[model samples]
Target chain A: MQRPQELRNLFRLPLPRSFQLGSFPLRSHLRWILIRIVIKTFCGLTNTSIQSLERNKVASRFEVFALRLPPRIQPFDLYEAILKTNFRFKQNDIVIVSSKFVSISEGAVVQIDKIRVSHKAKVTAKKFQMDEKLTELVLREADQVYGGIPGFLLCKKNGMLCPNAGIDKSNIPRGYAVLYPHLPFESADKLRLNFINNNRLKLFVVISDSRLMPGRLGTTGIAIAVSGFKPVIDHRGEQDLFGNILRVTMRAVADGLASVGVALMGEGRESTPVVVVRGFEVNEEDRKMNWQDLAIDPLEDIYIRSFKSK
Target chain B: MQRPQELRNLFRLPLPRSFQLGSFPLRSHLRWILIRIVIKTFCGLTNTSIQSLERNKVASRFEVFALRLPPRIQPFDLYEAILKTNFRFKQNDIVIVSSKFVSISEGAVVQIDKIRVSHKAKVTAKKFQMDEKLTELVLREADQVYGGIPGFLLCKKNGMLCPNAGIDKSNIPRGYAVLYPHLPFESADKLRLNFINNNRLKLFVVISDSRLMPGRLGTTGIAIAVSGFKPVIDHRGEQDLFGNILRVTMRAVADGLASVGVALMGEGRESTPVVVVRGFEVNEEDRKMNWQDLAIDPLEDIYIRSFKSK
Candidate 1:
């Protein structure tokens, strides 16, 4: 169990500063009391009254735009391509790039003809009813093969459960496969820095990939790496609507944001490799963070506990 | 294994109608050629060309607005309160209502003082370190209790793996708990019909709730029930970016939409129980669909396969 201080730090909320109410000067106390009364008046109003107070306030909205980039985009040219779409980047805007696009930019594509398949690769390929070269790639890329049905291998790649170790043949040239970016976290950080320097704006960058959930058809977006904000919002000490203190509610903000991006970046020929998510209010701090913040330790994970390792 | 015909039906995509390309009538052949040329031209364009072609095209966007409603609202008045927010409803808009709001409207609040506890409830409560009456309610609401750590219960409610069977204490009046709606699908359907009748418009209705994922901190939205659209988009035979046919990719459209809504609906004090999600293109079919379409069968689920049922 995490200590309260550590939990607060992990969730990136500021620790409350201690202050002595009794030590306040006489004038300060009067000001404080007046402020308290105003706040109390605001809180005492009914729900509708409070809403009508801010009826003109625009609600937070998000626009998911798919940038139609060329199929074989180099990593160095990705930023220019995104800007060419003429979508203006604002402070705190979330820019999501598909990992496949990042891989291609990083020159991570491998032509199948170059891979010399070994005996183990051939045997595993035959057993799994997959192509020999693809099986070899899956084995090399995966930390551990969890065994999968024919045509797919469930493997742990960078602490994530992925099909074929995220070695995808899609969106790449024929006879080649696109590996996940060599360093997704570094990739996101570099992009964030570049965007900040070039546009002089604060923003968040997320490298996203698709993954299937257990028993759900189709894939939802998962955040492979993120920069410019804390990934999780811990609501442990917050009170629920019933005034009951909530103990175990934390929002996976990164994953939820990635899902929003991926829903617009469809898997088909929509050709949207990048999406711009705006209007989400995120902490503006651009501190260094790791994708591990979103990862569940294998031991503590309920799904992993239930998993019978093949 | 599902037959190709049945798979197509389950995914709800239209099967290709058999026609001989060589035997097309003269006018039909001309039309086909024109369409082929247009599509080829669209596909062949570079990023800049495509952007310039549709320079004024707005990207798919969503706005999540919370409707502030008085507590203890009757179910019939919920729709009127939502409309009173003054947000315009357009064709194919998705209106998401928090299930807690739905439950409160349905008069599903249980006063803890009025409940009589059984011996089983009392012992189980002590074992789980929870309130005895709440445990009794959890026991009654749950289909099967899977045991839990202190202060939580792992149970199945409406075939969903929910904590405490979706019984919530938050956001309700004092000394009362809110139960999950008796018939979520019916609730969604009724809302959809009411919206259509009242506004003379087309739209999707989703009743959403928050739930924790197996090793993740915080909660994301899950769709309890949805009407006016297909919950899942199956991409079984669709070709991936690599030109290889995809076998198992089904997009959980409803859940993804729910997550988008829930991300905007903060758990604490953001009393916006209703959200209006605009601008995602959903298949606008008013056919009756069950929430079961989005459920994963336990036997077939990878995560469930590993679960050691207590």
Candidate 2:
């Protein structure tokens, strides 16, 4: 072809909703483009008044909830949050759970003053090529310091790749750090199951963190863990009219969904820690999906093998 | 914290225009949006018409072109087509070799009567679980019948994933089938290097094939391979302000770009085999891109990879 035809718009598919995209260095309209996002916020004094909404109750489609749990809320609060949010809170057309909140709820956080790193952690740290000072910090009882190339420091306690080694500086003073939510999968399961039993909505719960992609402008969340959404689209034993059988390709629709969700969730603002998105079309058969369905193995990660986040 | 704060206007840098998605499933606007794209198509074509458009001649923004080559096309006709299509003709804008014509120019077509089969291919055919009758017919000098799962039957040769292994009944009509264009990557490279050296415009050349995605509707063109575009984004040593250092993660920007380009290219129908997308940016370090970049190592694949995309 000397000059090729511009082949855009060859088919029909609806474009996403428009929103202010702040994450990319490039202009992105991927955020706020979906009309079904549900958000919860704590603004006025009414924040204290917002109680955990109960289960199976009807709530607004577009809700902004404020939750006040006991200090160091328990996993039960995770359920309560959903109940209240979805009851009078109503299920989000789409729901988002903050990684920090999930970690804290599951007691994923560690009080630096209270922690005592283990001997094993220290040795593992060294073997992984971690810094001595950081290793010393971990030896004092870190869950796991991220293990990777020399320059990059993933979380020491959790496998998470966030700043502070999966430490949380949020919901706490600057001096203290938080850890990833413990038993995130369990936490995810409970909420997902409860949503199914109660609200009758297909909920996609993701254990998301502010992941750092090197060279990219901002933290677009990776679905570190997820459930409910059908994660993969499998096309095996099928042929084109032309008859070529497709081999080994499944769309990572969940990650793209999570990426879009995180994009919509915005990078740590909107005080809507958890967002509920609605109006997406999916069937009952797709509910309560597995985390593995959505997870891209670290090895298969094209970007992962090639680059490391420091 | 119950709800994270909603972050507004997070970009310190301006968003690039590439991410400005007007809509998803862009099928509706195909008829009209095409007009805006035609302008781009003309620009790319006019620049490369008749002969290689020289580098730096009209190389500021990314432009699109439609080139109908020589042999099948007359130089005079191309020159006239260029002027009528657009006023510019530079070598810088070409993104890939046109495959349809490549097959024609290479003359890889073969008569059905004269053929030979590889024992390896025959064994492989049985491995595909083809029917005995067809298998017997195919065994007549055919290397193998390449398709089977359910209802698909394909020719034993030709590298295409078509009903007849991309073997054609139309192009030949009487009794011949076209093989895949030979040394296709070589043709792609010549066009690529020519753009790089002659027009000097930053470009990538992809020799594409229409492929089917499992579980999704319709086919999209995929790059057999590519050069010039930064195929992958390696995010090593990167940290979000959250401070999580990433050990592995790279964005397959080129492949995704190709997928989107296919969406824009619209398979064989547009005959706009080469798509010149502007404003799509990537880290420039790895300019010599690879097809390997797109292949998720089998181990990392999660499906089939009972564990991952293994």
Give the winner by DockQ. Answer: 1
Writing each residue's lDDT as its tens digit, candidate 2 over B157-243 gives 322223334433232334444545555556666666554565465555566544433212234344455565555455556653344
Give the per-residue lDDT of model 1 (tens digit) for A78-193. 67667776665668788889988888878888888789898988888887689999999999999877666667777777776677889977666578888988889888888888
User: Across residues B118-180, which tens digit of lDDT does each residue of candidate 1 receive?
Assistant: 999998889778999899999999987766766777776776667788997776666788898
TM-score of chain B of 1: 0.78
DockQ of each: 0.18, 0.03
Compared with the true structure, model 1 gives a TM-score of: 0.76
Give the lDDT of residue A289 in candidate 1. Answer: 71
Residue A212 miss distance in model 1 (angstroms): 2.4
> What CA RMSD would you report for each candidate?
18.6, 18.4
TM-score of each: 0.76, 0.39
TM-score of chain A of each: 0.78, 0.56
> Which consecutive 10 residues in model 1 chain A have the weakest lDDT in total?
A1-10
Stretches of model 1 off by over 4 angstroms after superposition: A1-54, A57-59, A73-76, A113-132, A145-151, A306-310, B1-59, B73-76, B113-132, B145-150, B306-310
In model 2, the runs with Cα more than 4 Å from the true position are A1-76, A79-92, A118-147, A151-172, A196-202, A209-220, A266-272, A275-277, A283-291, A295-310, B1-310
